[model samples]
Target chain A: MTSLLYKDWSIIKKTRALYFSVLYFSLIMPSFQNMDFFGKSFLANSYYIFIIYLLFSYLTAYDYKYNSDNFIPAFPVTKKQIVAARYVFVALTFAACLVLQSVVRIVILVLKGQDINIMNIMDYGQAAILILVFSLYFGIVLPLYYKLGYQKLRLLMIGAAVISGTVSSVLSEVGLDMNRPLVMLFAVIISAVIYYFSFTISVNIYKNGN
Target chain B: MNKVLEVIGLEKHYDNFTLDKVSFSIEPGYIMGYIGPNGAGKTTTINAILDIIKPDKGKIMLFGKELNGNACEIKQRIGFIIGENAFYEFMNAKEMAGIISRFYKRWDWGLFNKYMREFELDPGKKIESYSRGMKVKFALACALSHHAELFILDEPTSGLDPVFRSELMEIFQQIISDGEKTILFSTHITSDLDNIADYITFIYQGRIVFSRDKDSIMTEFALVKGRKDQRDMVLGSGKIKGMLESDVGFSALTDDRNWFFRNAPGSLVIERATLEDIMVHFVRGNKKYDKLAI
Candidate 1:
């Protein structure tokens, strides 16, 4: 397991361009905007960062298909270790993104003479909730991407997301808070359930991936 | 006397392909040549052995243990080199080796570097910059560097030149010289196996047609060529599996080589069958015991 982690870390470092780009957009770009716009921009910035992280996570699944990490499976490593290492890698990536986001938020507040309430109890609570939701959402998506493959799932995911977003926008004009915090909470629960199943499916698929 | 790898009744079902009760065993100190034509279930069988694809039914025992429980432990002693250039294109050979080294507990960096030098592989260049032969050589270096007792290779010689192929074979011979390691090499390159394999297993249409000692298979199966008039005489013998008849005469596969040598005595060519000829004869479905040229 440690070996797997070391391998992934080295790969991630080698491909640091992707990581740096994400950091630049999420953490560096927001500071260039005015103070009054910081709060509003924060929401879009966070969501954009989430989307990019999700895409990177989805793309990492191709490591299996392309045989990038093919030799690892043939080593003295169990399937469980392989999956756990992957999960840990995702967790670390997200953690790095979160830290970058936090640093940017702090810098914006300082430059704006804003009340230092950003990291307050409510703010921390919201951040914690968002992390939980995003983690659960990704836990459901990453393994499926690995099993179904990147090409098929990438098209399906984009198509489905587009259709669903359009429908949700039209419904919101008719008065819908489906994107509200409460709804997000409920969705998180549902994602957790799906995540459990997806995890099991990936385990079975990988065990049989020869 | 230890059976390093044992596969019994292994089957994998696909929409277009079904691997039937395929079975073979590799004991320490011998090289098993897994020969077959394209899409002949050679890779599928190897995949099942490595648990890459779960078998529909059957048992795979490695190191005297059930495969499921001892996968990691069993895998530790095993090395694999697939036909595909499976590494990331962005990674140089040194970086790739470092990544690979972390996976095995008994990785020997010194030995890996030695093999890389021997194979003329540059460890600092990205795989994308490598020629096909270089990629193969690099992969082989990484695979053999670890303390592997058994090596499973799929078409390791496919794109390599004859000289390098011979060099790689020599390496395998040296690895097994101590009589404690084993190799299971699957390839369509018959000459590679002909020069090295102790046991030969032929797979056809997802099933094992035959697996025997190399010398025994060579002695048992004979390819006969003759003219058209001898067709009846050959068919009368009823020893042919199947035959292909052309304008020049016929070519066939037969188990009774001696019978053909003694009975069909006119203008017949009884040659020592090469591994490639045997593979082609079986795969072509021309099983006639006697091959008569018309």
Candidate 2:
């Protein structure tokens, strides 16, 4: 299981564009709050989610591009295990970025003698909400990736990420109070259900070659 | 397990191509050559065993365990190499080998390094920069390092040069010479298997044409060359599987070699059929391959 995630991580690091994207994102991630589109923190948070979706897409693209997708299944891992590992990797990538961005933000603020809220409960809640919402988008689209492949689904993944990210952000701004501690908890349960359902579909599509 | 692999009543249906009840098995410690023409379901069968594609109606057992329920466990004991550059092209031999090492429970880095040294491969060169033969050596290195009991290779020697192909055959021999490893080597290069393969499983149009030991195949099949006058009798012979003909003569494959040599006219030429001839005639299809128009 660790091997499969390592494979993805290795591919991500080897691809030049993706490696640079990781660097570029981490540098800009600390400032996602400074840029806003419609609602306060809309572009900031939604763009982060959108970029995460793209990073995941690019990783999948690289695998398909390199023909490693063909050989990955031949490894000593089951399809279900591969699916589970991917889901975990997605969560890990998001978590790692959040940690990095927070550290950088804290350092920048300290260097400027500004207030530090890096470990604020509200900030963690917002991060959790973003992950739940991101999982909701991934839950619907990842299965399609297994079916149609990375090339055909690349545009759809991007377009869907933008639209879904926008709609969720808009919802949080308007009525849902998605930032509420209670709603964030609710989102977690719902996101888990979606993740489970999507994983089952992805595994079936992959294992049966549908 | 007595059998390293057993595929029973295997059937996969596509709109245009269907694997119809494909069945074959390999006992432990034997090199089984899986020979078939392009689009003959060789890859499909290999994919099924690897669990890359599920079979519609059949069971695949590897190392005495059902593949459906125990694929992860069964797969650890199996190592495989498909086409060249199956590894990521951007990664060097060492990088690829390092990642592959994590997949197997018993990966031996020392053994892998030994193979790299013997193959004369530079560990730092990316796969894209390596020649086809070198890429194969890299893949083989990774496959062998895992201490796998069964090795499933698909067209491992197809794109390689003749010298490297022969060298690869020697490596394959050493792998199984210990009587502890098994190989299911799929390829159209029948000559490579002529010297190394203990058994041959021929698939044509998604069906098993013949699956038998090389010695048995050599003893049971014969190539008969005869005058036009004797063509009818040879064609009518129940033993004939496939035949090729010319205006003045005819050549046919017969299952009963002794009977063919004894009963054939003194003027006829009869000899043991080589593996290449056997595959060519079988792939050509029995009567469809005949040149009676001549």
Give one digit per residue, the lDDT tens place, for model 1 in A44-85.
434533454554544465464557544556667787787777
lDDT of 1 by residue, B104-175 (tens): 889999999999889887888898799877887788788888989888988888988998899889988998
Off by over 4 Å in 1: A26-65, A69-71, A109-122, A156-197, A208-210, B285-294
**Candidate 2 residue-wise lDDT at B185:** 90
Worst 10 residues of 1 chain A by lDDT: A118-127
DockQ of each: 0.52, 0.68
User: What proportion of true contacts does candidate 2 retain?
Assistant: 0.75
Residue B127 Cα positional deviation in candidate 1, in Å, after optimal superposition: 1.7
Model 2, span B1-294: residue lDDT tens: 489899999999999999999888999999999998889989989988888778899999998889998888888888898855658888888888878988999999999999999999999988889888888888888889978999999999988889989999999989999998999999988998888899999998899988889989988887888888887787766677788777888778877889876776788788889888887766563656344221
Provide the lowest-lDDT 10-residue window in model 1 chain B: B285-294
